[model samples]
Target: MKHDEFIRRVSERAHVSAEQADTLGRAVLQTLAERITGGEADDLAAQLPPELQEPLRRPRKAPADPFGLDEFLRRVGERAGVDGELALRGTRAVLHTLRDTLPHKEFEDMVSQLPTEYRELLRVDHDEFVQKVARRAHVSVDQAQTLTRAVLQALAERISGGAAQDLAAQLPPELREPLQRPRDAHAEPIGLEEMLSRVGEGAGVDEDLARRAFRAVLLTVRDAVPRKEFEHVLGQLPKEVAKLL
Candidate 1:
């Protein structure tokens, strides 16, 4: 509760708009990102006073179950160290899309091909949902069902209703809060090489924009990559960096 509230508050602060909250989130996400990245956490906390600290603390919790619709989707994300709730929303969206377009047969087929490890996580209901969709799509029962489930989950993540908020609710407050206060966000801490690599790779950026973006990350709550980049590194570059002086 506290952690969630603190994030909400951080988004609300005069100095830290909602978009900037996301910047704070990125900067303080990893331990190495904090220590090695250099004062990333301190920079974020600078905007938030001690008074805001208490609210960002939530209780520790296990990620949601894998069988449940919302929880199951959440669990999938948990594997990636992401909160399940947020993940579910995406799943939900994909499901919504499947219901609207993809035939049941295609949905089932997709699931059958899922890695062996995936079978252990499903429930009868989810299976049934796939089965039904499979029949409608007029394809292999097993294969179509899987596809339907996959399609739904994929779509839900992009819908963006409350993915972050829902995920935050599932996490322990301390773990979540500390994520907000990474010790250093600008230095590109060593351990985060993979994370940074993933981001750059996923974004298809070839160069090392990590540090430049890291500096701007502390300024956005909206996740507007370009805008925030301009705001911190570009907008105030001369004044904030002071190389000229």
Candidate 2:
């Protein structure tokens, strides 16, 4: 793809301006180049637009710098003059766009060199989260969006404040907002039926739809969060409700 299109895609995905996208994309590519081998970086540079190629090409003579995702994001944030959160979002956007545009084997080869924690950058974003809910619940994206908010709001209310904050940390910004709202220090211990009723009321849907949406949201959350964190969340719930997750 052309440079403009590449930047545009990153901007849209990251919800940033074109100038910001350019800065962030270059930051990520530069950091990525440092992480991968010189030869692999050259291969990656060859596939990208000429404008973006330089960042990847610069470090081709140096040995790969071994680092985890947190360190990678830190470097990207430092380079881009942005905070860690924006750096994470921008990196995901650039990488996701790269995955969409690059040859499958090329993308796979590059990712293969990285550690498992690096792969977590490709985890569900807001769009993917909504799409999963829509697909699983057999609803439209609009309806799924509503259902997602409803269920998550109810979930935030039911779980302890710490658990809710931890869960929010794993999700994309849009989905994270609802869970970040103020709540009690301890879990509310609301029953499954009550949670469903709250979801139904919040979403303006009936009982069946509410149940389906609740299940869909929880299932997505299960995949989105770490097993230990999710277990912590489940521990706050009754057996009947925890089983749904």
Candidate 3:
């Protein structure tokens, strides 16, 4: 898709304003340039609109830093002056659209340079999904299982109504019950600290442990869901909560 059409589709799917979508697209593309190698970044940029290619063309003072999807989103959120949630949504929109616009071989080449988890985000299956989380978090399978449930339950609570349903449909039948559980409509939106505290409480762990578990869960889900749908879920959250995702 062209830049304008790409932004329009992202705006429509993410339920953000046109200006917000533009801001998001630019932020994600710029941040992505910092994550991949200079050569791969250039190759990817060549496929983008002229206006969108500037970030990739800018001289890098140092090598691209090693980071995962969470840190990548954090950087994008900072650059975009939006919450982490919006950044996540914007990133998904741009990346997934690029996958559609680029040739199969070209897209595969770009993906090859990214970390394994990055590829997992693009096409996550159930078994691999759990294994990736366990490996990334450095936890046992049982612990990963518990963390995944907590994160998904918290996610279902925070995202929009339609997004919640869509996410439920993506999950296994055994895992669908948590998303279907009734939520308190009058509950207020909480910040990252409060949200993590709740996750810690629910999982009976300390704050530090809760944060680690949340990260594992968030990263896994971010990759498992379709990009646009993930974006919608992020857009519905408070900026603080979104940053964690």
In candidate 2 the C-alpha lDDT for residue 194 amounts to 97
Candidate 2 ranges beyond 4 A from true positions: 1-116, 181-184
TM-score of 1: 0.18
- TM-scores, each model vs. reference: 0.18, 0.54, 0.48
Tens digits of per-residue lDDT for model 1, 136-241:
4444655443333332222122223233233222333421331231222222222334433443444344335432332222221111122222233233222332
Q: Candidate 3 lDDT, tens digit per residue, 162-196?
A: 56777777665655666664443322466667767
By the TM-score metric, which is better: model 2 or model 3?
2
Cα lDDT tens digits, model 2, 1-245, are 89999999899989999999999999999999999999899999999889988989854567788999989999999999999999999999998788757875687788878998876877778888888799888899999999999999998888888889988988888998878855557778789999999999999999999999999888777656655666797787778975665
Ranking by TM-score: 2, 3, 1
Q: Output the better candidate (2/3) by lDDT.
A: 2
Q: Report the poorest 10 consecutive residues by lDDT, candidate 3.
A: 179-188
Q: Candidate 2: lDDT over CA atoms?
A: 0.87
Q: What is the C-alpha lDDT of each candidate?
A: 0.33, 0.87, 0.71
Predicted structure with the largest lDDT when compared to the true one: 2
Model 1: how far residue 232 lies from native, Å: 13
